[model samples]
Target chain A: QCSLDSVVNKRIQEALKEYKPSIPTKTLSCVSITSSGRLSSCPAGMVVTGCACGYACGSWDVRGTTTCHCQCSVIDWTTARCCHLA
Target chain B: QCSLDSVVNKRIQEALKEYKPSIPTKTLSCVSITSSGRLSSCPAGMVVTGCACGYACGSWDVRGTTTCHCQCSVIDWTTARCCHLA
Candidate 1:
């Protein structure tokens, strides 16, 4: 049963791979979910900016550093996503 | 003086604009610092993922939704950058 499940999962993953391209093109940053039900790691030369948080992150002052920072709500930064500076 | 600051700010912004291309094109999501030293907003189709935080945000299960989420350390999520799922 486990083997069958693994095969099924692999097939599903393969299908997903075919369905999607390695990201559109010239994409600076992108997001992806994983089997563990979480966001996947970033691609090359990219980093994950945890824009969201459990508490309210008033504002981020990452100026003079790189491209920019993410936008977080005044409420808990629960919806924190990622950004890429391409 | 404030007026001069505004003018200088505008000139600096224009210079920065020329120095940078509107995100180098095809950006799914990105970050930018503001005059006040805060992150700018996301682009049209994409949203900001606050993957970082002052507290620890374990793996975010955004698998069902769109592509994925950001990455945060077990630490205080300080270095939480951004991701663009391109």
Candidate 2:
């Protein structure tokens, strides 16, 4: 049987290879708002991930902003809650 | 109700504000190995996030590197499998 190790190691190598060290804040030169208008992003290479809220609320109209209420009537509504990843 | 929408929106604002744009590769000044040694990180503001593997395997030594084998003997063995974040 093929050793599971090879598969595991392959993944490890992949993660390590994909890992991109972050840039320091002092040197970052540019920051811009995303087209969605909800979140901003770094154009260069210092894109930040894992930065998100517990949930998203409200609705977005044709304008770049959400049109729904910025508040939820109940607790933990998946669809009603806005989840943004950028 | 206090309004879940407000809570959701508050989180949204927090995420948008925390979003950090990346720096251009041309301007990136430095790159170095992390203290852990397995992953490299950017020293500047352009830190990459959401870059991780699905699992973690093996063991890690007090030393910056993991001591575990890069392989899993069984399928979907969470402990035997290695998942990395960073």
Tens digit of per-residue lDDT, candidate 2, span B1-86 = 23544554455455545656576534232211222223323333433321111123222222123221213233221111111222
Q: What is the DockQ of each candidate?
A: 0.10, 0.04
Report the TM-score of chain B alone for all candidates: 0.23, 0.24
TM-score of chain B of 2: 0.24
Query: Pick by TM-score: which candidate is best?
Result: 1
True contacts kept of each: 0.25, 0.08
lDDT of 1 by residue, A3-32 (tens): 654555555445444443244354444443
Q: Against the true structure, whose DockQ is highest?
A: 1
How high is the CA lDDT of each candidate model? Answer: 0.38, 0.29
Local lDDT at B84 for model 2: 24
TM-score for every candidate vs. truth?
Answer: 0.23, 0.16
Give the 10-residue window scoring lowest on summed lDDT in candidate 1 chain B.
B32-41
In model 1, how many backbone clashes occur? 31
lDDT of 1 at A20: 32
Off by more than 4 A, model 2: A1-26, A37-86, B1-25, B28-86
